[model samples]
Target chain A: MAFQILLNIAIAFIWMLLKNNFTGVEFAIGYIVGLLLLFVLRRFLNFDFYFRRVIAVFKLIVLFIYKLILANIDVIKIVLSPKLNIKPGIIAVPTKLKTEWEVTLLSCLISLTPGTLSMNFSEDGKTIYVHAIHVPDKNEAIKEIHNSFEKAILEVTK
Target chain B: MTEIVVSILILLGGAFSILGSIGIVRFPDVYGRLHAATKSATLGVICIIIGTFLYFLLVQELFIGKLLLTILFVFMTAPVVGFMVSKSAYNVGVKLWDQSIQDDLGKAIKKAEKKARQ
Candidate 1:
């Protein structure tokens, strides 16, 4: 992943030097051009892993964004309602992720989603404490988190 | 054609920002307000930044590293700042809404304290 990113950046630099247009659009075009070049050279470079990882990351981002919008709408609805009908609570979620970076990314993802906040990790690092605004069924909510965010994060990061 | 799209995006971003501010004004408690600011406000800011960047990318014809950096900075910092604020509030014992249904954290704290005292 890092190598591919570095390659993309190097291509952009070369493009800027050639076009003499160091603007954002030019850089973006350069990125596309770089991607194409990479595609053409894939057989020699064996860039299949990089391509698959990039696509997986994009899919994970899209899924997270979709959930974020849905969660935001839910928060807006709760706030605008005549009565405050929220059932706020903290949830202890045990995680299979063993690395600090993975746990940090998971926490960031959780906190960004509307109506949910990632509080802290247990000292042992095996569990995270998340606070959510509208959890009716704790087990179900945990299941959904595991199925969507956790799984997608692991898929992309791994 | 690009102008029209950027304009609409800018409008949508402005509207979300307004809604987020309204959420801040309308919410009952600190947690509610945190929800409004962190989620809606972050999205609103991201949208506006993205729209502005698009405008520059297309109409202005200047590729700006700063614009992209600004968006990335906001995306990374906003949620962490929000998390810090909420964590401080919770640690200081800012009460949840009276109608809140659960207290898993409170329970956990109590258990931790008991373990410490033993």
Candidate 2:
């Protein structure tokens, strides 16, 4: 990732030097040119381009924001309702995430998303214990976690 | 105008923050309260920060990058803090609400212990 960024920067500088146009717009054009050049040469490179990961991260952020809004509305409805009709519980949510950072991210997303708070992780890190405010069905809750946050996380990290 | 938009954002943020506080008070258990506190509060903070950012950029003609940075920082850290607090509370044996429907973690722990015994 660092190498990809440094190479892109180097390419941008080389383009500026060649064009003798050192303005921000020129630099941006140079960067795009470099980005395209790198795209063409990606097969020769051992590692993937950094921007793909960046784009995935951006998508994850957008998805997170969407989920955040939905979650807040759900919580607001629950809180404002006449009665608290919730079946709060802690459920074991198994994850396929391997790295600690990915698991931590998954946990954070789970906590920040609707109806769930990540309480603990299994010793193997393959499972997260999530406390959900409304667990109508354990399987359904698990599936929702797997479908939304876990899937988005897998895309970013893997 | 920009003023109206900013005011709406700030008001929405305040409402969410107030709701979060109410949630914390009304929730039955630590975990349930955390569900209220972190998520709503993070969104509340983000709303306020974006309002500030928009106000500066549109009304004052000043673009402060730090406001954006602050939102990102808060969004990332708030849940971690909640997670830590809940985990510590669990470790301290703070009980789950009696009405809670399940405790899968306890089951997992027991299953692990049985394996160790075998």
Candidate 3:
């Protein structure tokens, strides 16, 4: 992914030099040309086109921000109510992420999202111990993690 | 127009910060407190930083790379701090609130101990 980005930038710079136009717009045009060039020659490339991963990563960030806002709203509601009613619990959230960075990102997102904080990972790294402010149904919390952050992460990494 | 937007963002950030403080004071346990401290505070900082970024971009007509970097750094590190604090607290045997409904980690620890015995 990093190499593809560098290659794209290099193509943009070369285009600028050829056109004798060194502005941002000329560079953007070059970038598009480079993107097309890469796309046409993608079969020979060792990995997937960089834009696919880039788009996936963009989607993940959007999903993360959406979740963060939603969770913050939920927290506000819980905090403002006159009655203190919450079912805080430590649940063993099973994860399918294999890579070290994948697991780390998942855990970090879990800690940031909703009312959950990832306390620790199990010995085998298959499960993360998460402390959630509200877990009325354990299965629901687990499913939320799996379907949202974990799925988004897999899209980005795999 | 820029002033209105900046003010609103700053107010939102300030409100979240106050809410986070209230949560810290009201929550019953360390883990719960971690949630309050980490999520709301991080959001608060992000909001304030964004507001400042906008202010500098529009009012001062300068793009400050440092503000964006600050936002990124905080967003990345806040969770790690929360994770570390809660993990260390757990390691020291800090008790959960009485009202907490589950303790899956305890069960996992017990299972590990049972496996070790065999």
Say which prediction, candidate 1 or candidate 2, comes out ahead on lDDT: 2
lDDT of 3 by residue, A34-89 (tens): 99999988999887898998889999999999999988998888878888899999
Predicted candidate 3 versus true structure: per-residue lDDT over B1-118, tens digit per residue: 9999999999999999999989888888998888888889889989999999999999999999999999999999999999999989988899999999999998988899999999
Each model's backbone clash number = 2, 0, 0
lDDT of 1 by residue, B2-100 (tens): 889888888877877887888898876787777888888778878888888888999989888897899889888876887788778889999887867
Worst 10 residues of 1 chain B by lDDT: B97-106
lDDT of 1 by residue, A36-130 (tens): 88878888985564677778889989998898899778877876688877777778888888789888888888888857888766778888888
What is the DockQ score, from 0 to 1, of model 2?
A: 0.83
Evaluate model 3 with DockQ and give the value: 0.85
- Chain B in candidate 3 has what TM-score? 0.97
Which is better, 1 or 2, measured by DockQ?
2
lDDT (0-100) at residue A91 of candidate 3?
97
Report the Cα lDDT for residue B90, model 2: 88
- Model 1 residue A103 CA deviation (Å) reads 0.8
Kindly provide the TM-score of model 3 when superposed on the true structure, using C-alpha atoms: 0.94
